[model samples]
Target: MSKRLSVETSSAAASSLFQQCTPFGMSIISAGFQRSAQLLEMSSLHPEKTREQILEQADQEWIPGTVFLVDVDRSLAVQHEGQSDIVLIPQPSKDPNDPLRWSQTKKNIQFAILFYWSFMTSVATNWNGPVWGIWVEIFETSYSVLNDTSAVCWCFLGLGCLFLQPTAMTLGRRCVYLFATLIQTLGNVMGGVAKNVGVLYGVNIMTGFAGAPCDSLVQISTTDIFFQHERATRISLLTFALYSGSYLGPIAAGYIVENNRFGWRWCYWFLVIFFGALLALQVVFMEDSTFVGQRENETEVEKEIIAQVISKEEGQVYVSASSEKDQNVTVFEEKDFAAPLDIPTQRTYMQRMGLIERKYNDKRPWWKIFIRPSLTLALPAIVWGGFVYGVQVMWLSLIATTQSEFFSVAPYNFSTAAVGDTNFSSLIGCFIGMFWGGPLSDKFVAWKARRNNGVMEPEFRLWFLILPAIINSGGLLMYGLGVNAGVHWILPAGFGMGCLGFGMGSGGAIVLTYALDCYPQLQSEGMVMILFLRNMIGMGFTFAIQPWLDTDGMVTTTWLMFMLSVVFNMSCLIFIMWGKKWRKMTKNLYLKFSDPHFFL
Candidate 1:
């Protein structure tokens, strides 16, 4: 009778354990329990061991959730020789197939591909701006109309993502990337052959629509593959590539249009060729990083072990069945402790290419994907990020739209090639920011973590914004004053542009990294919010700047821009001080709106 009572208690405990383990509502618990019961039976021979002792033993084992064997206090620390202090947040899984577990070589390759794609797409977006001067004559359109074409394209760039990002979530990112590239390439071809300004306008809109992913998707992909500690650095690199392409495109276009042989149309042709190459590279290299489902099936014993480990880590005591009646039940399975470094070959190349490994079952209305991101604009951090980037975009548009006129008719009398060459200063600044921004922010976070007993918060990254804000404001003032005073053109073109690029690049990195760090679950949507505000603000500025300049003159307009920059840049202080409080306030809202399956 006593034996029967013990067995009944054991069965009840096992049933309860199975229920807790199967959160996804899988019915495989019975099968798993059968395997677990067999192991428990063997353990029944070891009656002397207490439940506490068993759990203590399990805690010491190198289980998934257990304190890592390398360091108990710093479980997330990597085993590198010099960088042992650097802890990887959102600790990488032991699974070989995990993207975070991928080799550094593979990660670098992926980064390169993403970087190149971002650079090329940005080049495509702005290449038309510098060549607009020549298109005025060829297309028989006024400068305002041609400028409007570029502004429309900028707006479409943001609007396209509303639809495309949802498709990326439903269909795989790789598929969306391929499709967008194809559309962009075709659009470029059409633009190259366009006979009239209307055709050019339509093609520009098409290209902008297709190229939208370049702004947001690449950053999302970076987050997908990299750990929290690595994201800021990778994002900084991506920002550099993006800004490089933006600054370089106009330079190349200016010269391309100036060349009598190739002329303005070749600008679009160049994009066609570039995107065609990019499309091919993406097909061969980019793989779907989206999680379909768990691919590994652990036996019941393994499941029990994992459960015990998780419970131990969470400070929950797990009383085994044997513990109820002083039975010696010790279940021990030989653990595979080796870390699998090589990529698994479970899926065939055809399956990878087809993206058919696991079909995503996103039941949300398709339009919700489009609508949800726009709703994120209400979030303070998201809005702040958008505002900071939008101001920068306004400045960028001001330069791109007005530079040709500024240089052509001024005391400088810069040739098209010289105008193009002037972008080198901006490029240099971007490089500086790319190198300086990410690592410094990362180090700041790490240092702060060290000071805070290893508790790292997202707000640590925002401290770096102060310098960038001041530098950007100063640069705008210098450029405006230099241009108005007709100080040697180099003063405005080189020093001013360089400083502006550095500030914009660094500022962009800070805000983006902060947003991603704060709400990683909503990264894609948050990015969309930033993109929408950025482009819309840019379009507004592009439309208003010419008229504003006519009325207020260059110095007043530029000083106004500088004041606006100061306001936006200085807003980072509010985030740094109260960002945490804001995040806490909006936590329920984010949980309510965010897709649970995202980053699965």
Candidate 2:
């Protein structure tokens, strides 16, 4: 009779706490505790189960972190008529202002615009790769000196993000996007008319800095508008645009350089014309997506409520709704409340351009932006992400540096157009990867979650890395060995280059998606870190590759690169086996360093 009374008292306390906190907060707290308890018991019973396996089980039982898991099996809120009831992780608010609540058509339109913007900028940045041979002769400079121009540009690409990210977050993405496009367009015009190598080098630095956002900002925008399940596929699409533009640039530049009527200068002229057109479209169509004020207030309220409930000194006796017999604790179903669809007052055309100034809380030190991204480099995941992206940049640089030089001389005397056309092999591979990588990753995670009883963990996505790893490693070896042996150019150019693109497309997508999944709140800063590392490493390789090739020859250099690729690609295993423990260990650190007001 006394024990029964104690149980009743505990249940009453839990009911009171539940009533105080929002359903989202309650679900997070309850799921975390329940999952922790299950892991403890499972570990004791089955010591052989890896932490990843245990975490997968925990995810099956409850959603990770503060994300509210939806019940797809029962929820009636369908995305479309034919679609099944897919669970929405980080359950969408009924608020019409919520990005998740936006009509699918609106989201798709935004994505298309962003995709085109990303593609154009990437094409402009890399068109110089295939034209390096022409530039060396025209500018009366050595190969090494001209290469430094590309290296400087790549380095600036990384450094530019240090300034761009904070400004975008504080002001608005639209403002930054327009400013970057305008500057890049002007820089291209300057580059096209430059008379000397020094002028061209300066222009490269200016344009490179302006173009940095093309790669980093798109990922942030995707996260701003899309859900977790949608991120992988969306990121894949962006990656496709990025690489396609990059490869296609070389093709176009090659033909342009080969033409007597339009030479190397015309390449820059083409970018000037294209970017000028792109800027006009951007000013007309783009809108600021940052939801700072409302999101910040909602986060504070949620935190205060959570604090009140968790501050109680009572023992761990609270009964969760999930504990009830035959009852599944679905946060979204707790109260079938729908907020009024409040339509925002439409803005004027100029207002839509986001040129109007808005006040922000600027008390936070601006230097934190620069400092925090550097600190994130200490994370194993960040370092790994850097390696995954950086290595691909390095390999591409190797090809860019060597391709024109080798093909224009000796055994197969290919014309400038032929040299440029060879990039088509890589373009095809990127297309394959673009299609295969994203959707497959999303599907893989969903399938794994279902198998684990409807709980999903980020590590489940890493399994797809294996096939790409093998393809990338094999391609590196093939390219190196074939080049050294003086085999048919197609062997290295066609098969080897194609494989590299395939691997880069797929592997790069996975690493980026993983980073976002690990720290959604700090995504802007996280991407800054990724860009910093990726470009810094890329710049270093750009500077080093020509000298290394000179010293080491094709066989030794390629073999060294191959070895590095294998080692780095294989490190995914470490994350798969112990990634959960690392996440748990860093949770407090992440919370401490990350902005508190940016809840999903």
Candidate 3:
């Protein structure tokens, strides 16, 4: 077999000699092509796969840059009739220098570092919610000023959420993680020793920015490490970190605050030490998670097979490369084959690192991230979930203020510390909620998806939403009534603690899962939006909460809250029923369509 081919301008060749290449070479190319076609089909018919299958597939396939391709622009990128060219570029080796395929041990360590970073960030944001009274006393300020401080802290949380995507896109996930962790730790320490409210607010801003990367980086990292089906469970676990930190924070704060000698300062000091240690751990564990290349162990035939599978699944038009270069390749090989032109020139280690940094440089502004439908939908969920989660977080204050006057007098005669103890029930509720939300959500979504003819609809994710809505409303109402009648304090405490936490967690899961299902492509953007909305909602609720309770009393205010909750819960059902329609209609407007053209 003899053929002539240009190195760079090579075109697709259909000659018989080309098809009769060496057995080893042909086998590798064929495998890669088949794999690509399968991947494309899977991505295209998503939600078609059941939950178990999805997760199973993810566990099996989710390697870094597992579905990536290289552009061979000069050639006709196509497939013959009845032959699906799944593989985009058979043996399209990524620069081995790419960081995407770092050792598993290294990746796990980085993930752990990110997890701790998030834990500290969330802790710093809400840890102060429980100790507002202490702040009022220490600063010798009016309650209004204390309220402002609280609002300020939450607003910063909001700000962090809002900026997360833009920052990640602009600064790159690694830079954001590295700097944000350092800044947040420093902020916590600074806030711990600060005497003035002004200084405290400044430190709060620092902490807020510092915390931004926790969610953003974790999201990016999750994408890096896991495939689509595994995303929810892994993201769910990441959220578990947040909830655990949030729940433990107040417990730790209450105990520390109970010690008269330690007071609130110790709470800040405690957070500082915890986060500082976390910062140190992250420095070693976390690394850049980007699309680096695979090793040669991944054979050429395997690459082509995978790429072919991906192409069909994605419904992309596949055009075959021209035969001009194919002819040249045969002749060249018969004489003395040159190095495969597809293999890129290797870079020095420093040069490769520099290239990565250059890619990390800021490209898009922050607001650009929110313009897409995937981001738009996901952001709301994040915000709402965050809002609900935050409200539950400060449930202690809401309960204390609303029920305190009633509990302090007459039969109860409870001290401040005892009031805090009432919160133990809510903590238990949170645990129940967290445990139930995880597996139930995974199972329910899978089952419903099967019932719906194997198409995974976003509505399926809303099944759990119903439980939380009813529970949260009923719990709030019970707490109000218990306080109104001055019944045994246990009534309000148990209802608020147990039911409230359960409801919040259920709602959180639905919102998160839905957002993810709807906007897998723009997940980072979606997460950022959700984070922003949630923190802002929390801040608003916290500020208005005291006033609402003061004006309407616990019973009336709680009833009103119940009504509001009912409306949103019911809306979930409506959305679920018509969600696909809504999503389709809004796909261009407010919904982010998973790139039908995307390769897994």
Candidate with best TM-score: 2
* TM-score of every prediction relative to native: 0.78, 0.80, 0.67
Q: Higher-TM-score candidate among 2 and 3? A: 2
> Candidate 2 at residue 355, lDDT?
60
Name the candidate, 1 or 3, with the larger TM-score value.
1
lDDT of candidate 2 vs native? 0.72
Q: Which residue segments of model 3 deviate by more than 4 Å? A: 1-108, 196-199, 214-217, 290-356, 359-420, 450-453, 589-600
lDDT per prediction?
Answer: 0.72, 0.72, 0.56
lDDT of 3: 0.56
Model 2 Cα displacement at 390 (Å)?
Answer: 1.2
Model 2: residues >4 Å from true position, as ranges? 1-72, 75-83, 296-350, 356-365, 597-600
Show model 1 residue runs off by greater than 4 Å.
1-72, 75-85, 93-95, 292-345, 355-357, 360-365, 595-600
Rank candidates by TM-score, best first.
2, 1, 3
Q: For candidate 3, lDDT tens digit of each residue in 272-291?
A: 77866765655544555554
- Pairs clashing within candidate 1: 43-329, 43-330, 46-328, 47-328
